[model samples]
Target: MKQINTLLESNYQSHPAFNFGPNSWAVSTERLAAFNEVYAAAQQLSPTLDADSRASIRQDLEHALNDIFTAFEAQSTDVYEARFLFELKNACVRLMGEELAWYAGQPRSRFVNLTNKRTRQDTVRLQRDRHFFGRLPEAAAAELRNLAESALGPCRANAAVGRLRREDLSVNSGRTVHALRNVLNREFKSLGVLDAVSAYTGRKTRVTGLALELSVPQATWWKNAIAGLERPPRTLYAHVDETIACPKSIVYLSDVTEQNGPTSCYPGAYEAMQLNPLQEIIGRIVGTVGSQADSPLKEYYAKQYHQSVNSENFRRHFMRLPKCLRFNSHIGWDVLPGSELENELAASEIKMTGPAGTFIAFDGARLLHRGGLMQEGERVALQVIFSDSTFTERAVNKLKRML
Candidate 1:
């Protein structure tokens, strides 16, 4: 009990972003008291209970915890409070054990409850952590690996940028390729991947694009490429693809290690970075000034107000700015190196690295992610984007009709 209270206090003190002004503090205090009273009662009743009494007490405790969870869920405007509640609930689950088993069984409405054990676990993880990982069947992975190696052989020889579009494959319409695509599509559909994506974006979604990528040592190439540019490629830094969400799945065709520059992202940032009106305004202004002509004025602005200009909060909000206003032709906004945001993101970073056949899915639009900074060895991967139908499929259909 003492440890729980200490943890609660420590968490509250450390996370300043959760502080939503005076009323929030009051609400937090009330919730804390309520949690303590209920938790203390459970602790007291744990020992010396007969089977019947234990069952009754367990039912009561479950209802109490669910009521608290429901209350926090209802306060959607106070995300910090919800985060706090999530933490406390985790603690309670750990301490109480089987008394709270029912809570663990209840999946969130946003995720499909698949019957397959592996897919079910992955779906639950994706719902909770905004990412999930698995592997393709070994035979399929081997075939894909061979195809990738063959396709990139020329680019590797010249040390050129390594990317192979789906259309560029020599056997793009061959049986092997079709079989592999069918396997992937079937696996993802069985896992309810599209349904999960639609739940996140609040619209229907489908697989929109696919490509093969290779990452090799490019230190000299990158230096020469960025020599006269205002900024390096945005992909070199952590960023989101758009204000609207687009999730991605990547299948590693080669072993990826830290030196191989596997994709990395800040977990939970997808949900945490949601902005209010004031944050959006500040972010847009800072982003606009930073993207202006690379002159003394731009340098001056960066130097004079770099703290706010490069802050993680402002930068995240800036990345969320509407596409029209931002005029960002690239995939996403870059978080400057050594910025406050980078430091925070680094603390929680999850690198997507594993043996060949490893597959991972994550939200690209909302999560701050970056990759392709390889230092040694080569990495071959298949990247696929699954996005809202409104963004890709419908437009394609409209074009077909016009043609």
Candidate 2:
């Protein structure tokens, strides 16, 4: 692993835009190389395995993709991660073809529990309570499912649709997501989450992006076999929006049963940094796509709006934190710290699981969170990321026709 201090001393002048200081802001070469070794072993798996055995192996590959995403979200650091994800995804397609690969990639259907370190005895009872799904009003779940289906159908026709997997979706896509936007807004307002969001960011926030996620089921054999591999869970990482001052919201659109994928987040992680020093060091870091104005998509948008566009815009508009909070010798902002944060994380962490209308509003730049791997049935949710007026205004104007 390249230490941030060494990286700063060597490359800081040449790559000023390089995010240094925060552990979450820098990539660990050691970790990346380790995952590469695992991928190599995965590539050599036997082809004669049964259906269930194949699914188990593919689940490990899925974690590999998630780890890559956690490493770097900036365009500059994306080539390797992108290549890694493609090869893993292709490995799945090669193993079981596209349809099953897609199924295995869904949130809840994972045959393994790779969220945290555990012994064989630790995960012996990874089953969902049947009653959990029944807790949600069936009518509401049905309504949301209809909305999700309708919302997803048109998006499938989009040029970018293939990029979306069961656990992820592209939010900025316009027309295809309009109805979902309306439905989600109404539901979130009803739940009082938008009010909490406004309070959090101290701004009249608007949804800047929307995504519909689905988590599906897996067979017992698949789960047991994969769990037997005993790979440690991916390290937790947060998605931070440097460009936006507002938080994000995700509303469950289906019964997020225990077996289905739920969101795992570290509560008070933001506040913890207010006191601890060790809490600020020693974790892999990455920037979020929203913060990259120089990115091709953002540049295209800037050109369409007849505005000056460059990577500098990203720094000027988003990265200019107050001097004390900027990446420096003592502290950094928007980072997910290392092991020191784990105990507090254990005490404060929240795993969100609920009925269709369940919702959570959080500071995207402050909180650390990850989408959970599912153990069973479909878990679907709609994510809406809110932001400051400037970014929201751009999104509004750009998505206006579709709305």
The top-ranked prediction according to lDDT is 1
Q: Write the per-residue lDDT of candidate 1 for residues 1-403, one digit (tens) a residue.
A: 0222222223323333222233221124344345445545644554545557656765665565556556645653444334434543444443355323322232234443345666556656666777777776777778777756665665465455433322332233344444545556766676576666555544565565566666677533222121223554333545555333457887788888988868877667545544422222223234333333543234433422123223333333322322211221121233333434435555677788888988778776545576666789877777777755564666899899999
- Best candidate according to TM-score: 1
The alpha-carbon deviation from the true structure for residue 83 of candidate 1, after best TM-score superposition, in angstroms, is: 41
* Residues forming the 10-long window of minimal summed lDDT in candidate 2: 125-134
Q: Candidate 2, residues 114-202: lDDT per residue as tens digits?
A: 34332122222111110011122456556666856765544444424443343333344555466666655665444444444443433
Give me the runs in candidate 2 sitting further than 4 Å from their true place.
1-142, 151-176, 216-244, 274-344, 388-403
The residue ranges of model 1 lying beyond 4 angstroms of the native Cα positions read 1-113, 160-183, 190-195, 198-204, 219-236, 243-245, 277-340, 388-403
Residue 203 of model 1 has an lDDT of 56
Error of 2 at 97 (Å): 45
How does residue 30 of candidate 2 score in lDDT? 53
C-alpha root-mean-square deviation, candidate 1: 15.6
